[model samples]
Target: MNALFFISQIIGTVSISAILILALAKLFSRRWRGQAEPARSRGYAVLVTGCDSGFGHHLARSLDLRGFVVFAGCLCPDGDGARSLTLQSSSNLKILKLDVTSDEDVQQAKKTVQENLPEKGLWAVVNNAGISHWAEIEWSTIEDFRSTVDVNLFGCIRTSIAFLPLVRASKGRMVYVSSVFAFFNCLNLGAYSVSKRGLEAFADCLRVEMASFGVKVSIIQPGNFCQATNILKLKTGSDIWEKLDSERRQIFSRQYIELATEYFLSTCRAGCEDAGPVVDAMLHAVTSARPKRRYLLVSAVDRVFFQLFPFLPTVLTDAVFSLSSMYATRTQMLHAK
Candidate 1:
């Protein structure tokens, strides 16, 4: 009994000490963080993708106001978004038609940027174009996965390769707008999580490779700001269900689909409405002389949970996810009658 009691006491003490240490480290990190180096925005050129909506739109306007020669890439240059942006900003903000998934569009965008750049070349390129779909892996088709990757993963690659020369010439920055799902996988968002994971890897590789050339690469991981972006405006669960064959449809009940759709929309509505935090991170990555490798813009609760995810046991995490899924399924079935 004495030996058991001593072991428990030691374990408790060690756990307490570790928690205290972590608290102190976090406090110090915030208190003694170094300020970013000042950078001049005037005459510096930046290319931002997905300027037709959300964070990209706001960021383009903000940078333009700050005197950075902003090259905003919109999928539809003549659309309402582009027209609205034109009306809002000065002549310094020029909208270019760019479809990151299309090589021809990317090439044209590169050419357009080249024609307008100052002698310093491009100063920054923000890869912000992305899309998301909601459904389980089994419910989704191969095309669904491919489409997501084409925009989220291959799109970034296309843009980065096309603009690397200009960025290298100016020793500039490349900022990728990744998602918090890159670090923590969530239910019904496998494609998005996988795409962001691939992006994280790509960014890490590029960051290391560009270090010798004076090009800085940074990634912004934002959590649940779907209301501020077009992430939740894609195909609904019912739409995908209708397209599925009878066999596949039978695998997932109608009630489950209804519940999933309701859950997803509710979650979107619950997300942060303001895109300011994410845009601020992007601006810092572009303009800061000493930019961070990764910027995580998440709420305090999300931050703690994501930080703890890597340390949690696999079984525990799996169980938690399974329980949540089961609960949702049960609730939906109960109301089916």
Candidate 2:
């Protein structure tokens, strides 16, 4: 009994020590989390994609106000969002008609930015444009996956290649607005999650490659901010049912589909309403003297969960997800019975 008690005590001490070391390391990090120096940022130009809404729109305005010459790139330059941005922001903000998927459009945008740039070159390119889709793997079509990847992954790649020269000249920053789904996959968001995961991989590779040059590559992984952003419309259960063929309809009951869709929508609606943390992370990545390689803009609980997931045993994690899946669809299961 004494030997067993001693062993347990040793284990406890080791665990506590490990936790303390991690905490201290995090706290003592030299990264500054403050706003960019005004004088240094005055003549620098920043190109922000997806400025039609959400983070891109907000960040463009903020950067403009902070004295950076802002190139706000929107898919529809004359759209309401872009027009409103022009009216509200300083004259320093120029609206660029940028469609990330089109090679012609991206090339034109690069030319436009080059024509207006200072001798210092483009200071940053913020790839904030992305699309989100939710459907079970089998329920989602190839087109669904392709569309999500086209916008979320390929779009960033196109923008990066087009702007690499100017950014390399300035030794500037490249920031990709990724999602927490890049960390771990969630139910029914497979297409969106896959795109984000690919984006994360791309960012990691580019980070290493850009080290030779002075360019900094950063990725911002945000948790659920569905209500705060226009990323997801409230897609109804019927929409999923309409897409399924007779065979698939037989495989999944109408009631099950309805309940599952309800669950997904409910989870999204229950997500964090404020995009403040995400925006702050993006700003820090862009303007801070020392930005982190990856910024996780999640809640404290979520941060701990995701950080720990990689270290846990696969069986244990799988079991936890299994239970979670059962819990999430308990009502549907009961109805089927």
Best by TM-score: 2
Report the backbone clash tally of model 2. 0
Candidate 1 per-residue lDDT, tens place, 1-337, comes to: 9999999999999999999999899757955895455447876799999999999999999999899899999999999999999999999999999999999999999999989986566899999999896677877788889999999999999999999999998888999999888867766788888888999899999998998898899999998899888766555666867877888666677677777777777888898999999999998999887778888888987788777776799887666666676566755675665
lDDT of 2 at 174: 95
lDDT of each: 0.87, 0.87
lDDT of 2 by residue, 126-173 (tens): 999988889888788999999999999999999999899888888889
Off by over 4 Å in 2: 1-39, 325-337
Q: What are the per-model C-alpha RMSD values against the true structure?
A: 6.7, 6.6
Clashing pairs in 2: none
State the displacement of the C-alpha of residue 333, model 2, in Å, after optimal TM-score superposition.
2.9
Candidate 1: stretches off by over 4 Å: 1-39, 234-237, 323-337
- How many residue pairs collide in each prediction? 0, 0
